[model samples]
Target: MTFTQNRLSSERLAQVSAGSRFSYNRTQQAIGIVHFGIGAFHRAHQAWYTDRAMDAGDRNWATCGVSLRSKNVADQLTPQDGLYTVAERSERGTHLCVVGAVQEVLVHPRDCNAIIERLSSPDTHIASFTVTEKGYCRSADGSLDPDRAGAGSIYDYLTRGLALRKERGLSGLTLLSCDNLADNGRQLERLLKAYCAENDAQLGEWIATNCTFPCTMVDRIVPATTDADRTDIMEILQVQDEAAVVTESFTQWVIEDKFAGPRPAWEQVGAEIVSDVAPYETAKLRMLNGAHSALAYLGLKAGYTFVHEAIGDPALRSLVEQLMREEAAPTVATADGQSLPSYAEALIARFANPALQHKLIQIGMDGSQKIPQRWLETLEANRTAGRQCPAIIAAMKAWFAHLRGDNGPVEDPMADRLTEIASRTSDAQCAVALFGEGGMMPRIWQVSEEKLQALFS
Candidate 1:
């Protein structure tokens, strides 16, 4: 059966699944947060949390989801009145929930002006972003990369919206970054300020005085939706849900508790609000995300398709252990009540979950943007201390090979330059070229070319 508003009712909720939970009063929910990048992960993780918060009577926290790059998500969700299904698949069992936390959905190209107005409104106290790493438009030197960001960048939209808000004499909004990059909130704030400074210094001052960008660490294993997933969701719900998301049962959100205005009681729903999110941010990036990237490039090079398949390989598993225990763990400054070893074990279990087919290619995408925090920073630290990082180097080498079409096709902002170097240079020379004068790698990391070249050798 087709899932439509007419077919959906209080009685129809039972038809979806005996245990599925949903809200019938979605119409009463007000949009308080404007979330960028409403992709599968956002739907599964942040939206799921917001749904739980709304269930607990946090009505003003309903999200207005905006697609910055494409209209695919907006189109998929609009027909269903911003309703979607999220299935938590784990070893224990499968649990389904229909998330109604999104009060409205908008595509940037079509509703650009409307989006500005929505975000600038007094009711919207927070603007959360999950625009992946590349969305920030940072160049190699951690500055705003205008060439990559172009006109449709998030910076462009956000700065313009904030300028409009200032023009309207409105209060500042809290900017939350839920991307996997280390110190994500700080990164966004820097980029946003950089862009604003270049265009409007006055607005930059307003941002500095009024706004706050809170760092966040979000952890969840959410695979891209597949046909089989859709089929299963339809079977369970007795209707088609175009925007259905599948994810692991485990989820965590660590946020810096700094906001300019009123905000949701996200802490009430398993989200840890901290005074300084740096320690937690550093740990997750180095441990969880760092290991995930390692597995992706290494797994692809070893001819494994899924993360589960990759982690199952004894040699690969050993490499992952080495990455977490020897390399990543030493670099992380463990926060209070945090255990690096336990986190590593939990990550291994999460990666090895056969029920969730997390794709290596998905993890391997946007390597240029992902590597600085995930590997390069640690590599630079190790190099500075005269320490060798075989596992980290191996992952980076796999990434270079990935760029060379050795593992697979490249999906990166710097694909052209990386592929050019890979196509022209030999294995050993590839590292020198990437790390050499006028290369993208050097923009992010300041390392000796000789050491980098040795890693390739």
Candidate 2:
């Protein structure tokens, strides 16, 4: 039997494993959080945490997931009543738990106006975002990109929704960003304010006075669900779940203690509510995300698909460790009393988790948007301090090589620009051209052309 609303019941659940189904009353859950980008990561991280909180009596945090672009997630989960299984894998074993966090879903074009209406409602106290870096539609300096706005991006949609909210005189909501960008909440606020100011000054003033944007850092290794994962779910529960999410048995969320209104008691369930999320955000970006990108490009070049396969290779793992320890850590401040050494050790072990087949190419996507925070800022800081980062230079070279049809087909907003840079010869001269004066990366390109060429050489 397949899992669906009609098929799920107390009697049916009794026949299944204890941890495989939610024991609580699903009927009582109501939507409070309106989440953009209903993807695997959200389902595995935020939704999971919210579901646990609801199960533990904090029932006001049920999510109404909205799919901004793709209808695939809605298509898969809506039929199941937004109830999907999360298979947590680790070296010890695997455990399955059904997540009932998202009680309703809205797919764009199907219910575009409804999404806006729901967001404008006073019940929706949080408009959370996990729409990736490019989804913000911002330029290098964090302002709203005129070109992206012209194309009717998320920024346009958000501005329109806020205008509607202002017209309705609804209370302001906290806009939370769970993406892997530095000061993500601040960036979203900047873009939204820029869009609103250009469209309606009065609305912009309302947002500035009413709304709050809180920066957050989320950590988990959630791989895209494969057919094998679905098969395993069927074998375990005698039911097919198309929307099952697979991930490692670890989770962390660091959130700034800033909100426009009341929020979930997420701190009750291991979330670190801090006054400032800058140090934690910077540490994860430079160490974990930067290392992941390094592994993705270098791993792809070495003909490996999974992260474990890349880390299992002693040489590649050593290079990654060296990059983390010798290069990336120096630029990132310590966080939560955890030294870089222990953090790097834990990351290395997490990456080598064979149970979760996290793909390399997935992490390597949208390098143009991802690279600025992951490596560029750190590279600039290191160079300004009169330090050289050979490992970062190597990773940058891998990205350039990856862009030029080396790893696979490129998927980036700046794909054409990357192709243009990659068109030059595959030598240190090309490196010089790409990172030198008048190239794409101005921050890291601050070094002399000779020095850039030398690093690549």
Candidate 3:
């Protein structure tokens, strides 16, 4: 029972009543280029850019979105016929975009051969990623993580991909990491090489010689899935999309122009291709993400449940703004050629958007994963250049205080992790003590620790 002369799956048949059936007029497929760690951000940012490029590139840029961790993506996307709607939840209103650029979905364990097959394609132009900071196998010192004891993701993915590529003789694919980590591409290459060296040296050299990893800085506030989003998306697009992604009205991607093969005109799709993404990336991390994490840890402590709520509260709002304007902006460059003062103002305005309802817990999750990429790297850079990092320090100290389960007027620790952290630390001093005990922090952290201790204590 189709409403519009279309062949539809039962789910889409029910959800999207009107649309034509597949006439085998398939859109363009790319040269086996696969993106690792496909998530909400990838769908909203990278895939959006790629889709626009593919449409303009005359179908020369199709993507096979690869999920190394979940069957959720496959289950949601496969049923929808690989189609979903992206909703830009904005201050003014909601904007909907139906994306058809992702031609296929492959789960790592289930579709190993398919992933390799995509990479081996000679025409495969670029393999991009936004796997978050933890996805890269960097250690405390910011080089590749050496120990593979717990079977780290960075090691596992590269280990399998390199071994498969060698067996299949697939050469010269670009690995572009769009996470917030500093020197992201170089670190990614090191991780891949580390995996190869441990298992096979020749493979390491092959990866070193053939594969190129490009660093990138991406910005966007894409919240987790919500039921209302599902309903609204269904109402507007009239589609039953389980893997649909929702994000804020804003988005930005700044990538270093270094790729192994043919790439997308990301610039055509409102992305920036720059000589060095460092300044831009650093600015975003400090201004946007650093501010974000600061809000998450501190705001949650201040008894505010959501990011918007915290921003609305006078005290928390002051804390967020002061850190950004007074402490953070002096140290970094702004995107769109905006002044630091203006950038902070915009960020405050964006953060305070009442409609977005971005959750603090979402930003707060996986601090072990986020800080090295988002916060500490910027702090290290500032310190190295003989620049001051007082704002970053205050944010860090505030974060540490948060870990200790104590805030002055509002003493609220996130309920879920309380038991585990309590077991780990008896008090705030002990909590602070854990930083040097073979943790993710290193010498630069040591340099900043004294300053942070003074602020919190």
Candidate 4:
């Protein structure tokens, strides 16, 4: 390619420096679209989609990456003039692609002023977040979480920024939440509204009257990039890059058609912009994410090191496929997509991909936060039907076992829950309460504690 990494890095301020192959600077040409929680998944998926949007020249929807905490955004993105790399891989082969949609980057507290200014700017019309499922600060029924006290860091920032924007007579921006949580956008609105209500009633009213939070469903298996991925890209593409990313071949984004400013023609570039994201969200959460959780827990318990290892194991892999059949397929409700079984089969094939190297621990890191979204609902669905979910039930059993810390010496990092459960080992009832019953599967609280103890204990 004519635009080489050396040529690009010499001229630009690199954002995140991971030696990834897709780092370059086409960012100066675009406008800001404020983004929070700028992680690997955002770079590999949303940024990639925006990069595709940028290809047409009329759309100037650039991204601004802001960190909530010490989210390690600068550790990767700032060295080579805001340049980084993205490495996309699947079973077929690999490709090196550069994403420069994130035009500006900032870390909070230090760059708090900059973040607020960007949010208040009229030109900055879209505010999207991938702050994680736990980050939403929402309630269980998909509304704003009422539990938190007034004006936390994120909420404070939004409150102040929106007030400033209103003082300048600017309209509200589109707030898109890309977390795996259900009704992510609406949930964000709840949080935003709650914050605004406590701090400024006018701002709250303005947000209710003006802001548009579009519900979205995004799916992709974007793995964290590593040093080995750098070598692989260098060997294959014959290019040296400093922030390459790695992800599976499959990617899907379903956005609601609500934008305050001009958005990229993502629909033109293969993204589905739908009216109701519910069905899409359900399918992805239940089938794809559910299977993923099942694999991570079950795979680890079976002594497998990585996701590929689990898929490679005939017994474990068969067990996962069975879960797909019994639990995942029936609950999936996407109205205009392929059948759930077909999707699960395809996902299984992707999971078996040796090159992607997705780690079980990486997938299993936030099991406490992930399982409710992925598996619990389906488990309940199976219960309602009175069906035999030996494999899924067994996986849940293994997950609880994992949480209980029976298998290892190091106390699996994912076993913090197990440690808590272990504390109540003497009192089975208290222990059972930890899992919301049987000390396992806290998300499925409706299920009887006695039954969970019978199954898991």
Candidates' RMSD to native: 2.1, 2.3, 4.8, 4.4
In candidate 3, what residue range of length 10 has the lowest lDDT sum?
17-26
* C-alpha positional error of residue 225 in candidate 3 after TM-score superposition, expressed in Å: 1.5
lDDT tens readout by residue for model 1, 350-443: 9999989889999999988888888877776776677778898788778878988986578898899889988887767887777666666744
Best TM-score among the predictions, by candidate number: 1
What TM-score should be assigned to candidate 2? 0.94
How do the predictions measure up, each by TM-score? 0.95, 0.94, 0.84, 0.87
Question: Which residues of candidate 1, in runs, are more than 4 Å off?
Answer: 1-18, 443-446
- Candidate 4 C-alpha lDDT tens digits along 399-419: 666665544532332356455
lDDT of 3 by residue, 159-268 (tens): 55655667776667778888877677877777777666667788677777777787788888888878877766666664455677888877888888887767777788
For residues 1-457, write the lDDT of model 2, one tens digit per residue.
5444333333344556766766667777667899988899999999888888787788767798888778899888877778788899999988988888888889877887888887887777898989999888766555667878753466656667777888888888899999998999898888887887777788889889889999999999998999988888767876667788999888999999999998888988888899999888888998999999999998998899999999998988988998889888898877668688888999999999999989999999998888888888888888888887877777888887898889768998778877777866675776776567766653443678888777777
> What stretches of model 4 exceed 4 Å from their correct place?
1-28, 138-153, 235-240, 405-418, 426-431, 435-445
* Candidate 4 lDDT trough over 10 residues, lowest sum: 15-24
Hey, what RMSD does candidate 3 come out at? 4.8
Indicate the TM-score of model 4: 0.87
Itemize residue pairs with steric clashes in candidate 1.
Answer: 140-443
